[model samples]
Target: MRILTIIAATLGLWIAATGVSHAEATYAPQKVVYHINGTGGENGAGYKPALNNISNHISAVGADNLDLRVVMHGDGLGLLQAAIDDQQLQGIIAGLKNDGVQFLVCKNTLTGRNIDPETDLFDVWPEDIVPSGVAELGKLQAEGFAYIKP
Candidate 1:
């Protein structure tokens, strides 16, 4: 029993010294894409929870080990629009961006909706625009990014 206790303590020490939480070590690096096609109704209600899930996912998997992207098209563009006026949402987005999350906007949505990417959306760049959101989703999936719609 004493020998077992000592071995357990030594294992714990090694884990602590490695600077990796058990959860982080347990999860392999992941390529994930989140789909956003709706505005989640007024005030971007569903957006916050979805963003929160991404935050939680980063926490669990460790940002360095994750390739995460958010593809927003259709009414989903409202996420950026809503963020334009909502500070909390903006902060969440900025935090996610700082953690290396890529936000992809759809050009088709922009042209169809008559929304100006530079002037209307929040913190979106030219490189961030994809020709079609759905196509991007498919491409990402083909590239082995797991699909998630939340």
Candidate 2:
């Protein structure tokens, strides 16, 4: 029927117009938490990829629009270890922090590994260290922070 055809056409046009309007609008604030549990060593195999993922994440959601946090636990503490002597990594981590990306280390991991946070982790404060990394992540998720494992 002509009426049915006209109705479909009108609906389609309305949807198209609404889509265009939405495309022109800015996005709301996005929050994300990245969990790192893998250890990447001198070969820079796994760690490099995790770093790239973090970089891509920041790029995807304009850094300014994101409340990004990297939760390091288990073997992932190697990232902090890798940065210990590397000034370049320390600088990059500091820059990321300055841009609002937080780096959280697990206190349990430190105690289990017999590692001292004061010397091993650069720029990490006592308050930033959580009692349980995974539990903290779950808490963050409950608080509406998106979860990511990279």
Candidate 3:
């Protein structure tokens, strides 16, 4: 029993020292798109939870091992609008973006809603605007990205 305990401790230390752990085995590389079509609630509560979920996802999968996208359209555009004023949301978004998560906005929604991406949205670039949210979602799915609506 004593020898077995010592061997176990040494093996564990060796694994840690070598940076070889179960995390790699536990999480496979993933391509995922999160669909957001509605604002969750008032006071940014609607999208805050969704953002939290996205953060938790990056934490679990490890940013380097994940290819993640957030596609927003319709009422979902409310998220960016809220972020424009909410510093907390902006921080969260910046962190997610730093983690390589892409936030894609729908152009159709912007046009129909008469939202000028330059002023109405938060940190949205021309490159971030998609022709259509739903269509982009379909394209992503067809490209082997797992679709998640939350």
Candidate 4:
């Protein structure tokens, strides 16, 4: 009976090991787009929480295996406002960018607000400015990128 118990335990261990290995073998890269249209004072503050989720995702899948982009338009353009108003907020954005996060601003919002994307936005370049935020979201999804709002 003791020998039989030992065999059963060995088999259980083998099964558990294989199950873990199978799960790890299924790892796949992820592409995600985060949509933010809330103003900085309230809605913009939500970026921190969204960023936390992104960090957790990268932790689970590894940074090199993750493609993440943030689209900011409408009142959401206020996200950059905190960074503009405070140097600390600017550092926060810089840190995230270092982690391969992409921040895309909307040209339509900039034009409507008479804000210059090149000069007014921090670390924002011409390429970072999409023609329209909503349209960009659609394009990203069509390109096989999953969408999230925070």
Model 1, range 1-87, lDDT digits (tens) per residue? 999999989978988998877767779999999999986678877799999999999999999889999999999999999988889
TM-score of candidate 3 to 2 decimals? 0.88
Give all TM-scores, in the order shown: 0.92, 0.76, 0.88, 0.76
lDDT of 3: 0.91
lDDT of 4 at 126: 79
Residue 43, model 2: Cα distance from true site in angstroms: 5.8
Q: After superposing candidate 3 on the true structure, give the runs of residues whose Cα lies further than 4 Å from its correct spot.
A: 1-22
lDDT of 3 at 5: 100
Backbone-clash count (model 1):
0
Pairs that collide, model 3: 40-46, 41-46
**Worst ten in a row by lDDT for model 2:** 19-28
lDDT of each: 0.94, 0.80, 0.91, 0.79
- Error at 47, model 4, angstroms: 2.8
**Segments of candidate 2 deviating more than 4 angstroms:** 1-26, 43-45
Better of 1 and 2 by TM-score: 1
**Order of candidates by TM-score, top first?**
1, 3, 2, 4
In model 4, the clashing pairs are 37-76
Clash count for each candidate, listed in order shown: 0, 0, 2, 1
